[model samples]
Target: MSDSHELSRRDFIKVTTGIVGGLIGAIIGLPSVFYLIDPALQEGGKDAWVPIGKFEDMQVGTPYPFSFTRVQVNGWERTASSFGGYAVRKSDSPDDLLILNSKCTHLACTVNWSAEAQAYLCPCHDAKFSMEGEVVDGPPPRALDIYEEHRISEDGIIEIFFKAG
Candidate 1:
């Protein structure tokens, strides 16, 4: 009877050791597999200079909606979506243009240039921004983010770069 009990105890120890080893192997191997597969899955992951429109399409002091797609990659996958904004050419002086992000600094609401108020107004909370994108009143903490714009070729194609951060 003692010998039988000893054999049972040894079997239990072996089974528990095998189970623990399997779990450890799974934990270590899964991450390695993911790392190997990640880059291949992100074949199209790149930052692109999206074209807003022809430079001639925009006029000074007029804001028009611009939309573009941004592709992003994460562990083992690639994701893409369209992002848009109301881009404005504030001045035509010296061929320099000002591009303002449409998202209001306050509460992420859409800001519209109010001809009556003579300011960018957030309808959600009544926040106000000056024509230069400065926060004039309400809960906006800072000015709107300005985008860098460039004109490529004489065809008047306007391109803008957006940072993921």
Candidate 2:
């Protein structure tokens, strides 16, 4: 009877010890797992303000296509992505700058400025946008998307803010 009692006591301790160890591990592990997966479950990307160039570089009445690069952070990796847009300096005032995204609002195609046509033409869909990004003639649902956030620094540099989506 003594030997049997000792065996039962040891078995009960082993079972309780196993359950307690599992509970402790889950308490520490669940939060760590959620923290690692939070970014991946996010809905949208982030926005950043980047300085493209100086205001002096823009030519009045002409839409100049400009290229820029932005860095993206994901999980533990940093990557560089290139972006482009058109900057038009108003013919009347140098302070009046119109910035347009290079991608067409229709199909995300690159729109090229046509000097003769006097419009932004998308080669892929043949969609036309006027100087002010008004849809001229095409199947596009709307005009080109504009980069609304822009400012001139005290030093005359044009800073543009864009979102990565």
Candidate number achieving the greatest lDDT relative to the actual structure:
2
lDDT of each: 0.75, 0.83
Worst 10 residues of 2 by lDDT: 1-10
Q: List model 1 lDDT by residue over 120-160, tens digit each.
A: 88999989988778899999899987886555556777777
Q: Which ranges of candidate 1 are over 4 A from the true structure?
A: 1-45, 71-82
Q: How far is candidate 1 from the true structure (C-alpha RMSD, Å)?
A: 6.5
Model 2, 40-154: lDDT tens digits are 7875557877787778878887887887877777768888877788888777586578898888888888889999999999999899999888899898898888888898889
Error of 1 at 43 (Å): 11
Candidate 2 lDDT score at position 102 = 82
